[model samples]
Target chain A: MASKTQSKTTAEFADDPINASLTADDKIELLRKMVRIRRFEQTSLKHYHAGSIGGFLHLYIGQESVAVGSISLLGDHDHVITAYRDHGHALAVGMTMDECMAEVFGKKTGCSKGKGGSMHYFAPDKNYWGGHGIVGGQTPLGAGLAFGVKYLGQKGCCLCYLGDGAINQGAFHEALNLAALWDLPVIFIIENNGYSMGTSQVRSSAHPEEGLAARAQGYNMDWAQIDGVSVYEIRAGVNKAVLRAHEESRPTLLEIKTYRHKGHSVADANAEKYRTKEEIQEHMAEHDPIDFWKSTLIGEGVITEDDYKQINKEAGAEADAAAEFAIKSPFPDESEIFDDIYWEVDNNTEAGRTGRHFFHG
Target chain B: MPREITYREALREGLDEELAHDDNVVIIGEEVAEYNGAYKVTEGLWKKWGDKRVIDAPISEAGFIGMGIGASMLGIRPVMELMFYSFAYVAFDQMMNNAATCRYMSGGLINVPIVVRGPANGGTNVGATHSHTPENIFANMPGLKVVSPSDPYDVKGLIKSSIRDNDPVYFMESTVLYGMAGEVPSNDELDEGELIVPIGKAKVKREGADISLIAHGRAVVSSLAAADILAEKYNINAEVLDLRSIRPLDEQAIMETVRKTHRAVYVEENKPFCGIGAQVSSMIMEQAFDDLDAPVLRITSADAPAFYSPPIEKLQLPTPEEIVERSLTIC
Candidate 1:
């Protein structure tokens, strides 16, 4: 439960103010989301291994708290755009599990209507930008969304999530400077899972001493990184940043320091070569966000052992049902291929008067 | 109140009018404000509208261009200006993948009404890096609309319409024609939407029968000039067809022109390799094959980057002399 306020990853739940503020139902609901994300990702991983889904599949197992906590504080007007590690972000933005899973299965009923696979899922109506495939690609778009909020005179903010490697990108710095100069409402979230696919921060970044958080100082913006293993702590960190973004039209660089239990993607075969199995197991056993919340709930006597079991069972069934829906959904028809390419409104009555679209020479 | 104005002034008027017409419209780019734009196309609008509407952005094309796309989806119509068309490579991903595809990818749930306008031709001896006519590259995109206007009248009308369009429009301008004076109607002289040239329509700059000279942007000027030379010297009557919109390519107009002349000469400022002329040449071959009296000729830039030297650059792009010669050969 250690967070920005507590300033210690070693701190226990006694000093965690978020827990005292939230009700038992609230805490259980957060746990349910974390469990659902874990189950959904686990099921997706199993299917990828079984060859149900084609292309690279990036799981959000150990880093569930970042999406669960950060999304909880966002209003419906607030937007979210993240890298391909985005199943958790999609679900958190209120996309149905079936829709997200159907996209993974490349089905017609998918959120992106099967055009965008797992790495390119989008649900704009839900304010979720996309499941962008390119690393560090979503950084500029994040600032762009915030610039919209400012331009439209909307009292809202945008949360842009990217990996540790994204901060090194020139566009990232450019976006930060633009956001700060224009006073755009945006939060740049560096989800530092400590590796750029296979290479760790030690091998990737220039200023790895202070980690990704230190670079925000170069942009003259407020910055912080928190223990991403606790959803409560993650929420607390994002709460201040989001408030800062909306109230003052200030952009913040908030890094969620966590680890992914799986390889970078289903195709990352050499993950073990870069990291040891013992190191992986140790993070899973100790810093797992889902397990941490589960024990915290039980220790607080918020839920019984049976209740926890029931939650887990429900989460598993939901993930299984989502997969089943995706399996039953049909592939997009050939005619549908040319349908959404351009909106039909422009083809209708336009502003200009030349009805005939040609000049007879 | 029809009066002569420079193409740059006409374009600035269009942006200024659009900004006044709709609160959602804003001009965003480097030097678009305090510096009065890279080419002075947005000279006084920044002072007129202030920083709220006319914004001066960093030299980060990818960042601001992407931001413009995002802002447009949320109902802010962004007129993003790249210093040159070649700079589109910096924000190519956002321009192609995000802006162009957002409407389609979101199942028509989102609309990106952003106009990316800048000079696209290479006649200033700026070399290969600064001079690239990317009409073919952008027109190839499905969801994105590509517009290129020739005269001041067309530029004013199309730029306004491109800003108001409910789609991502890549408005390619000509640096060579920026200061070229042309007759443009005053706002009081024209009715609403009358001055606004619709996308995807071709204009008949001149009518003839011997050959058809088809082009867009600055090449349209050469095509007209070539038509005059062919008429005066060779006694070959050439019809000049200026394609205002590249994407919604007026195939009917092309067929009409080819059918009238029975010979077609496609000219463009872009390189010959996979240029707009190539597409038009094939379209005439496939669609209006029976009407053609001779093989369609394409007069485009040399299949290489622009030369730094003025003399070499002059030989690279399609010239009026070359177009006249190509037209004569085809006729």
Candidate 2:
């Protein structure tokens, strides 16, 4: 007997907060981050259509606020790992637009050196592990990070992001069970963007009504359900989880309800096949994260009409510059083929590249 | 000071020694804590290191394996043990896609210093579902380093090295050889630190001029036995080459053996089609073709699911008698 209003269960965690106070600067910055992500994705889609970008391209247009709000709450030392829809996540965690754009373009200066293409965007220096291509593949990796954090006595926690589609994977259950049993400092974030590829959560999951967060009680875990369209709510939910992780060494399952404005990927453009255009338009009008946040900022006197317009314009320009940088970047050299396979001693993967040249032998 | 030790004990000793040496090193798996490991390879580690160092994971291979990979990226060295390598099939995406590609795809920015060790060979009549020699499958991946040791001495030295190495190393052990004993170096005999065996290096267990018996894992022991028979009965000088590491491949060592013994006979417990032997034979024909006098012969398991029947299962694996017989043709 679960209700759609999110209060059917006693775990309406998004309503309250443990010190979710945000400064004016943090609010304005988060707003701009959302804008930057939306503009960057929009630009990538435009280029993908023009044949400038290749491969299965998934955009983080509708789900910008989730990544921005959640990551802003974590310290720079904390780690963030997510699924393939990660352009927004990478940007929110302070990845340079030029490097990310170059990565998607498969250029040499890309974060993954043009080898990982779009599905993998990793920056270990920034503590953003990478966006995994597999649906539930990165679940255990979060546990690993949390395990390391506890083992080394580091204060940093781990944030694991995944789509609603990944909830059904056994890795999710296994990871949650261990996370709870060990009381590790890891927060499992589920960005429920309505459909997993073409199938909605209702059709794919066994217990979809209670929200994926409801299953936390089974593992004796703490959980919250966030209205993902609201950046304020997203921030509140993550802030609470982070506090508990730091104080009690607890893991929480936070389900952020959101949607994808675009198709699953650039390849899946036929949105009309699954649902009506009216539903899409209605969601854009009512629940668009960017629009919702923009109105809040303007209403609260955070910015003027001119400021809002400028933010969008600047994000668009930044994305343009990134695209230019990526276009001009060179492809990797022929010698790069035999590198990064093994590490002999230190972090020198390119070692023995010349010595072990089997082609010469 | 070298002493006789079981492969199982030798593996446990490596885990114990590493746990004592590095605080970042942790052992994680099902039955590894209180259950003393499914095979008793980590019998006293949990008691020694306590719960924080030695952890027992849920029966979720994909989850814990991925967690191990994630932890390793953050400077934790996790030696994760699977009850059987067949269980790894559940976590293939994490093991192959994530663990193998993270370091290379990240432009060498991240390191996955995780050791996924388990019994990978088939001889226990555990049926098709439980038995899987997947070294070739893992070795095929570029960013991964595959290690399959033959004896207690090799297992003790190499498992320690696999733990120390800053890469994803798949350590393959055999259930049949776990109880078997071999001479291992004591602390006094070895360097001040643990014995470090280099990955991707093949060892010549026996010397010969007529033919080379190249193998890995349990097949190495069988090949050594086969070489003894070939020397005593057939009057053939058969060289036994133990390929401890599979991925970096040690192409130079393989070619050196091929040059020494012109005839080659490859033995593996994995299936024959597209197996490790196939790759070895292909490499020989490509690089060492000039030295080979005959076609590279392979004695692999029958290309089918491992049967539950003990006798049928025995026939499914590559045996010492079969290796000796196969070497006769190549010789």
Per-residue C-alpha lDDT of model 1 across residues B229-274, encoded as one tens digit per residue: 8889999998999999887777789899899989998889888888
Residue-wise C-alpha lDDT for candidate 1, range A172-266, written one tens digit per residue: 78788888877778998989898898988888888736657877788788888777887767877888888898889999988889899998888
lDDT of 2 by residue, B99-204 (tens): 8888777777887889999999887978898999998898778778788999998898889878887888899999999999999888778666566667767788
Candidate 2 CAPRI category: medium
Please report, as a residue range, the 10-residue window in candidate 2 chain B with the lowest summed lDDT: B191-200
Off by over 4 Å in 2: A1-20, A345-361, B191-193
Clashing pairs in 2: A140-B66, A140-B67, A141-B66, A144-B71
